[model samples]
Target: MVVSPERLAGAPHPLLEGLDAGRAAAPAAVVIFGASGDLTSRKLMPALQALMARQQLAPGTSIVGVGRSDLDHEDFRARMRRAVEQAGDVDERAWAELEGGFRYVSGGYDDGTTYKVLDEVVGDLDRERGTAGNRLHYLSTPPGVFADVVRRLGEVGLHRPALGGEFARVVIEKPFGRDLASAEALDAALHEVLDEDQLYRIDHYLGKETVQNVLALRFANSIFEPVWNRRYVDSVQITVAESEGVGHRAGFYEEAGALRDIVQNHLLQVLALTAMEPPVSMSPQGIRDEKVKALGAVDLLDAAEVSAEVVRARYRGGWVGGAEVPGYLDEDGVAPDSRTETYVAMRLRIDNWRWAGVPFYLRTGKRLPKRMTEVALQFSGVPHLPFAPTQAAELGPNALVLRIQPDEGITLRFGAKVPGQSFDVRSVSMDFSYGAAFLEEAPEAYERLLLDALHGDPTLFIRTDEVRQAWRIVQPLLDAWADDPAPPVDYDAGTWGPEEADRLLAADGRRWRRP
Candidate 1:
């Protein structure tokens, strides 16, 4: 069901006309370090097959699974095949093209022999399967082992492409680091074994169709460009809410909390895409340069401002989706005295020529009422109104909402005149749904990210500067919470968040949207 832009037959894609749609994946051997893990089965495996179905993966491309699961080549192939079949439709010829070169290396990441065997397998693929001495290494292992694995590859001389015009890249999964110091440390560790251009720091949120559509909506359409500034916009609210609690990731959540888990990477990346100015070109560096600038423009809040503008809370036990769920402390593997925060809300300002005084409010949490991610910008109200106050009392300011998931659409909301002898106005929405507008369903986020990585495009991935600025912006909050051992305030699982979050908005006379 995944369709590439080039596969639109004789028609051109309106949104991707001038921008980089990226080329088909070149011939290379994709090496997954944690092939037996949940991420491999749930996302990576399906994504690779989806690319093959869409014919984006080149013919000489092969797959190599490296894990300690005690699975041989046949066993790994069977497991991956079942995963792909369950995901969606599969092209027989595409499977045949890749199945013969499937190889598995069973060993530990810290051991030396793992790389020795991996190097042999890759060499064989290059000579026998026409892989062209190119490689795409994916680090799906735990964060603790990321450095060791990459270093091992370097020791075995597998860090760079051996042939001319061949590409070699590494795709790193997120939760990049705990804070600013750790993020810099990780960057230093990676640079020792790989160049900046060879590393892909992927954040799946950036790969979403709606997220990428932000560029086309703002740059391709002239209606949005002139008004997308502080002069016309009052405030921007971005939300990433979840209805379910952390069911299986309690151990990781206890260490990361909401700040590192969501804010540092996912939410901040989305913020950059929404707030950034138009790039000079759609090339990888051009887009990345603007994103880094947008994030760099954010004013780092001081400790006093941190306490006043940010709200962090934990979820207490309550009914969710008609079922009762336990509180965060009651969850398995969580400490009874844990000070970890499950929800966070903060109001931020970008100090620059375009967004000098406008506030960008961002919040993310689990165990909320419903699952949703969106960016809503409300325009300033008219200075004067001719109608009576009562007639327009129900009308609200115009808003443009970009729904990233669930509904997966764009909504333009404005006041519409009521059909009656007496004039009245109420807000109505003009919606654009991807399903209703296109004949093909959009690809999964991982699918697009994987293809981009294979094609050596880092536009949708995070840059080092962007990551550093994100950590710098959140470091003050980290220090404040570290100095105090006080537990975060608690709210019911089914509620939006604590009343304290509302006060954060109330201070500015703005409120969180119900959506």
Candidate 2:
């Protein structure tokens, strides 16, 4: 009972098209490294199943899951089926129909011979199925093996132009690197084998519907873009927080913490889109160019300056939802005396003429009161107070909140007269909710990125320099925090963060937004 590709009479969503184009044009087969990992089962496979159920995959497209698991094609398909069923909303027929596309390759990442086998298997698929020599290489594996996999692919000529065909695109997952230097080194390693354009740096945040709506909201509407500058805007805040702790990722979280895990890539991408200038054209490069420029305009925080503006914290034992939880250090795989920061709050400045003097406060953390990701733009108060002192004081500055998750929507707040009040004013809000208004399931972030990678569109994905610029801004802060022997300030798990975080903004006569 799933929709077929043929039934998608109109243009498929832009995201789906991107995935299809990457597959169809190159006669490419998709090889997902780290095929047996949690990401593959929990996200990647589910996304592909959704694409297939929707009939968006290219004709003759083949998928080869690469992992060390000893599973044949049938076994792989069965595993993938369970994954699809568990992670997605699909009918049995959809699962049955999509199962035919599954395949597997088993080997250790360090073995070069694995790439040789991969080359052979891909060639066999092409010869038997009449698929053109195109391939989309997805590295869903750990960041450690990314360079090795890409290099091996190139060594075996798997990434080279096929017989009478073009090159394959390589897609990567998040936590690109540990820091700026490592990120740059990663770029260099990949560049040795793949051209810049052939790389898709996937940060799933950019794939969200609400995030994409940012572009449409700014460009499609005339009412807001004119005021999206320092002239009328007071400040902008981008936040990505989680209600859950590191959970199973404590090992990974020990090294990454919240900054690299979320801010450096996901949050920065949101900031870029929210602050980027309108591109001359909507082509991938044009849009990306504008974003890169915006990142370049981001002012780096000096050590002393960063210490003043930024605050990092560790979550301590506290009741969350009536259940007691241990502190971050007590999490499994975390060092007994680990100093990794689970929370980060920073006041940032963009040096460009458009956003100069605008204090953009960015923060993200785990084990907070609730899960919420949003971008709030606070506009300047009226130039003059035209009402009584009490009435005027009651009016808060206009705020445009773009709720990016949990409840995807846009809300505008303005002052209004309270009913039956003695000329008293109160803040009133008008909202556009995606769920209530559209009543449709928004495509998952991975679904959108998967489609875009298939379609060979790099616009929604981050470019190398964009990644570098983001790291550049945070590298200094990381260095300063490392140099300091002091541990991160501790906060109760259920609360927002440490008191210093409050004072980081309070000193400026401002406060962090509360839900």
Candidate 3:
């Protein structure tokens, strides 16, 4: 059960100086429940391996994977090796060092006896190695099993702080609830065994480099913040589109449509980061407080208002990436008469003075033409246009785009004079590309969240209040969708979305960005 510091290797990165150079605080035992699942293989294990490769992990830190599979340590390590090779870019030396940190145990979610055994195993590791009683329990299992795992950990005394002054933290995966009431229920169940600070609600979006860089882009820059208010900005658009269909997740997608899956959590977080006032400090709670305030001020949609502003659609059979894909109903595990929405486009208005009159258009969908997630801050047009009518008619509005994925970067669009004898103005983009400028690859979202958990930093993780407020903001939309008698419009695959999405923005004389 014990891991030796001498067995570990590699020097740490400059960004991880504080965490890696600290007094090799008591080693940590990270217990990942549902360790045999796809998420664990694709994200969790690879993230942990990346951290260990960077030497950010504390000395003597060990990973204990808990699952229902009857595999030995070597078998578990082999499985994780495949996962790491697929998901991580570990050098040979680093891989050897990280491989030495792996361990495994067989356990079920509802079995308290299994937790008791786990507690004993962890204690033995802590004693043999010098990990000062610090433990992080990551529940990567489904929402249905979260409560059982937490309760079992509590019953086995692993949920509470150790008598020897050790700390305990629990990290839960997303899809907090179906709606406001269910979100509250989920909170109540966890609060039984965990205090507010001891809980880390994982929202991978918060961990992205570009997303975190937003704080610097806004708060650190005086130019942007001055005009970032409702005065200069016309409207904001948040779009997260995917070019792939629901492959094997149709069962989960059926119950949780576009609204719950994307809008409720991911879109809201993006909105908060975009709209929040500057925090006094970058502390976890300080940043979360501002986010909570921003989310709380969001204008909740009423049934009628929601119906008018919202557009939902299901993608019918069509071509995506030059190949044919089945419709939602035809997807595996999808019911024949499914009514779930695969796409959602809605316009939201903030009631605060700073953004009182401005609209924030949010949209997301699957099986689209391209995979792009971006936030566009559309600026107001010139009060008076001096250009000729012919030329003015061909130009679009100015926009500042913050691209989060596919190509993580920032682009600013403005009308510029063309280099010709004739006076001609055309829209030009000033782009700041992440890949071109920074040769090193940015850490995956999971890597950032896992390292933060190890260091007891919750700055990028979602707080309980933030989660509730997010659900509160979108509650009306949920109600409207449930009560609406009309069926969603159908959009073909490999397209932007339903025609209704275009019409939603056309009402304001604006259009979704074509990228």
Where model 1 places Cα greater than 4 Å from the true spot, the runs are 1-23
lDDT of 3 by residue, 12-109 (tens): 42222322323323468888898888999999887777676677776567778888889777888899889888874656665775566667878777
1-515, model 2: which lDDT tens digit per residue? 34456655665534233223323233457899988889988998888777766766754667898877888888888888788778857656556655556678888876888888888888887776544787888998889999989888888898875785555889999878889889989999999999998999899888888998898788656699999999999999888889899899988898898888988998899999999998765678878899999999998888888789899999999978788999998888889889899999998899998999999999999999899999999999888767898875667879999999888899999999877758888788999999999967887888878877777778789899899999998898899989999999999999988999999888888888896
- Per-model TM-score on C-alpha atoms: 0.95, 0.93, 0.93
Candidate number with greatest lDDT = 1
Candidate 3 has a TM-score of 0.93
Worst 10 residues of 2 by lDDT: 15-24
Ordered from best to worst lDDT, the candidate numbers read 1, 2, 3
Residue-level lDDT tens digits of model 1 in 1-515: 34465665655544354334445777899999999988998899888887887788888788999988899999999998988888776668878877888899999998999999999999989988888889999999888888999999999988988665387789999978888999899999999999999999989998899998888789767799899999999999999999989899998899999999999988888899889999876677878899999999999998888888899999999989999999999999999999999999999999999999999999999999999999999999988877898888789889999999888889999999988987888889999998899887788889988988887778888888888999998999999999877889999999999999999999899889998
* Per-residue error (Å), model 1, residue 195: 1.0
lDDT of each candidate versus the true structure: 0.89, 0.84, 0.83
Error of 2 at 343 (Å): 0.4
| Structure candidate 1, residue pairs in collision | none
Reference-based lDDT, residue 218, model 2: 87
